[model samples]
Target: MGNNILITGAAGYIGGSVLANFISRTSGPIKAAQISAAVRSEEQAQKLSKLGVNVIQVDLVDETAVKEAVLRNEIDIVVHTASAIDGRIPSHLIKALGQRRKVSGEETYFIHSSITTLFSEEGGWPYGQVRDTDTVFEKEKEIGGPHPVRQTNILVTEQAKAHGVTSFNIVVPHVYGRGSGEWRKLSVSIPAYVRTSMAHKIVYKFDKDGHPPAAHISDLIELYALLVEKILQKERIPSGEEGYYFAMAHRTPWWAAMDRIAQSLHARGLVAESKPSIWPSDKMAADYLGFPVLYVRAMGTSSGDLVPVNAYRLGWKPKWDEEQFLASIDDEVQAVLELDTVKATIFDLLTSADK
Candidate 1:
């Protein structure tokens, strides 16, 4: 009977790290129950068992199973870490808090996994599509905008307050670091094109030295450390009245991020480019995307406006470079591919020998 905390999506990219952080804390025994990643596979559960994390299955879609899990586990605190990037928060939220599950001697802390990509789409959102809920949410007077996750963040923030549950909306901006999640895929978002181009040319300056700030995984963990204190110990979370707090570090224009990545690749002479167009060179591409490439080209604009809550004033500053940061990611990709290649070669050789 541990001071049981239930963390959903425990094996995912973000959740895995979060779970690991909790397990390593200086505090005494704080037993955590993590939902396995197998989706529904017993074998995956067995694999998770080897990791020493209390593992189980509780799919949010199945209402009966969810309720039963909550009841059976006597879950004291729930860190609802699951999120669907495609704006599934609305459909899921009602069910998540709708049913009356016994949470005795138990408190719930709902933290949202909303990302910055929601703003990456076209039509300026909610402004164009019917489901584009931007207008409606702003009408409800929620701060922030058109991104679907923005609404999701707002919803969780509001619901946490409404239900007397402690909720905090941790809005992560282009999070990148050692972990394979955002650090790996982020190249596709901001740094990839320019970093890759560095191998060929030298035109990759960051729109006049734009600041492309990034949140290190360690800085993020530090933020969560205080957050855990605020919620569980001091019982000051979900400030019912105060809602979402953006969890991004100040990374500048997207171009700046790209520039940093480019610099690193250039150092290695992997690529080179001078005066490479940071924004979309063709209007057709911009029009097709419907979102402004200016967001990428301009420095200290869009992303800079998203500041975090002062409550987390750990005085944390970003120390990682987008260039080396991303270069390492490139290294990881190459390394993994190299491993796969070796495996393939070994298998082929073995097969030939058998033949």
Candidate 2:
């Protein structure tokens, strides 16, 4: 099989950053391999094309188009970062990879990005303090709920196994720091909080405090690059049922972070007070933050007791700690002020279904 790789959602936050990481490598298997970026818009295609990678503008929901892109590009691996909830898109991509494997007579791989909140009590995970080495797939299937993330996770594992494609799920935590992508430089949770605070001229915090797992954007990208490097070198690592890699660097103290944000905004004359006010209700917070009401509480307050053993086993070292993340609140605010140009469409399906 050819060493060509395809990255879906190439214009999205995580996907675009992964693309940037792959291309910036000076000497590695990734540098020698052909890279293809699958974007959804002509504008995104044009902008990403300037980086000199093959940018394919194709709707991921279209199965035929997805298969064509994979086969034509001779893509051996697919880094799918499009949607954690939409199983259809990954289904198409995985099936396409299966077809490619048959044609090329070689193995194929799929790396799926998922949410860590699903493992918390608030997110319906009955078992507490789960490790990445645990049987995450079985437990998730046993607790089966209406959560789209969990459902999609099950879909990815099952479908990939059926297609004889090796799969790994990167259980993503609350990611922060400025991204190096061409589009959507800022992450979701913190930037939304900053925007909502500036809009109301006051910072709001949940009545209940949370300490969610988080990682710096750079560290998260490094984890991706490391996994890709391992795959390209044909190094045997965890895959299939035991491939849950938690991308967590530190724990984000929500109340404390909000307090710092309030103080920072107040010092800058952006807010009326230096102390954050308790959110009146989850509904108000959801409406203001533009997050799905059903998952907003979990997003803001659930801290999954996750023990990441897989990524670290692959020699993943994260430089950021809780202290560093707390100290960087000001930088997070500045990133929102400058690079919040791309409107997030990740929650579009959830919001529309709610309506």
Question: How would you encode candidate 2's per-residue C-alpha lDDT over 67-163 as one tens digit per residue?
Answer: 8999988889999888898889989999999999999999899999999999899999899999999999999989988899999999999999999
lDDT tens digits, residue span 186-224, model 1: 212333343335324543333343333356666665565
TM-score computed on alpha carbons, candidate 2? 0.98
lDDT of 1 at 57: 60
User: TM-score, each model?
Assistant: 0.63, 0.98
C-alpha RMSD for every candidate: 9.6, 0.9
Highest TM-score, which number? Answer: 2
Q: Note the Cα lDDT for every prediction shown.
A: 0.44, 0.91
